[model samples]
Target: MLTKDELCIQKEKPNIKDISLELYKEFSEEILFNQIFVYYFTNGTTMRIEFREWRIYHMLAIQHINGKIGKDRFFSAIENGLTLSDFTINDSIKNRYKIYKERITMFLCMYSALKEANVFYLPSGKVQNTKNAKADYIVFSEIGSKGMNIGLMKSGEVFVPMTILISKPSNKMVYLEDAIPMEVERLEIINIPIKEKEQDSEQ
Candidate 1:
């Protein structure tokens, strides 16, 4: 069997064909996808948008999902997290996700739409990466200076699996995107509102 890297290498030229088509075609019911609205805790909405913008390593650790309706659609947060050691990214889907993941606004739209479908991901019921440059959902990452260090959200208690990364010879995370389902369950933490700004009281 070929290693993930070897399989990823074979996927350089993406074909418009996939085995999932048969399964997708067989689906009869038209399920609705909901767009989860994640109100930021400390960082605020801007911070949530930040992680959605920079596909941080931590953000990629969790499963992200999206869908469309007519010409327009939405995005949402679901409850699911994948471990680095347990993710497997398919070729075509991997490339497609990479293309879409880069677009922040659109990604959020997808995230929101997914909410309509009632999707949400809460790994171990604990969201990490609070120091994320802009905590859209609280998950973030810090690579080398010259390199692109992702800073995204931590919808809930999910960890960005090492699987969804786009492989960089210098940065191995790049090859991890495969395991990251293009339409992964959003990582939205519920019943636990993030606390912004600590109380600053002095005598």
Candidate 2:
């Protein structure tokens, strides 16, 4: 059951509990006592969605960006899941999702690749140091997307649950804390889409 604070939602949070529960139920029937959803956020992060029962944490980064509460088709598509807006050869628009499955997969790979490259480049810590690198640095090249940022990953820091918030409007290359769910939502049956092509155009 969800609490009042969870339901209050202040027009700022997204009420995804119902959908989450539906997913949870499906998961339970498929696999006993399984209650979790995959969550994504700005910045490079992913986490096992939990049902702690709260409103603020119930919302996803997409909902926060799009002005939560809209019946528009675009949003309806997004709420389904944040997949890239791709039209298939069959002339069908891709299923929308709150999280981009392709993006998540690529992000994991890019993160690893960046770490390895950085470690090799700055083994002396003068060029780069994963533990304590200054944000003042910038990677200048026609490399990845302009918005892609290399954030600080600390030792013993549990990061999978954190959303990767890229502060673009701030005119800075970075990913910072936008919000943290006091309680993450849980669901029974989340129809995570079939894995699509590993790449999305326009990054």
Candidate 3:
């Protein structure tokens, strides 16, 4: 069984490779970087923008799929918070994560496309000053990040295990695009939406 929120999220997960191919053909590095900036790097503290972007994007991806927030609301909040610099930078200090984890969901989408298009990353890690990993991307386990079960085949194809969060655990890799649940009964919540604002107004 899966929750209704999870089902909604599963339906929205995109095909990464297909998106990679399309974006690679039609975009520039600056455009991709801007998406990274607004969605992932805007609210970061104690880290340089260039360094924090990748990790934040990964966090956003995990959190987004887990039903913490939607892609539209996340970016829309950012735009509403920061309307200057033509949205190249965010100026709002408050509401960084209101009803949202870290204002993300577009990190890997743009990352896959940029990597496929040969748009490169900074050579050194910004936080530690060491050389970053020599792979296409690296994963970080931060607060609120979820684990994605992935395996690589000898043929160079990647397999991702797809299972409902609330269902009995299964290590089954049933399909290539297995990030979302395609077959699971959904459970709907029966109450007022649980946000701090709603709770506060009830008193």
What pairs collide in candidate 3? none
Q: For model 3, how does the per-residue alpha-carbon lDDT over 98-129 read when each residue is reduced to its tens digit?
A: 32222232222323222222111222312121
Clashes of 1: 64
Per-residue CA lDDT of candidate 2, range 166-197, in tens? 22334432322231222223212243322321
lDDT top scorer: 2
Candidate 1 lDDT over residue span 1-203, tens digit each:
22222221231222223212122112101110111234333323221221221232223322242221111111211112222212225665455455534322111122222233221223323223222223222222222221122323354442221122222346533322222212323345232222221121111
**Higher-TM-score candidate among 1 and 2?**
2
Output the number of the TM-score-best candidate: 2
TM-score (C-alpha, index-matched) for candidate 3: 0.19
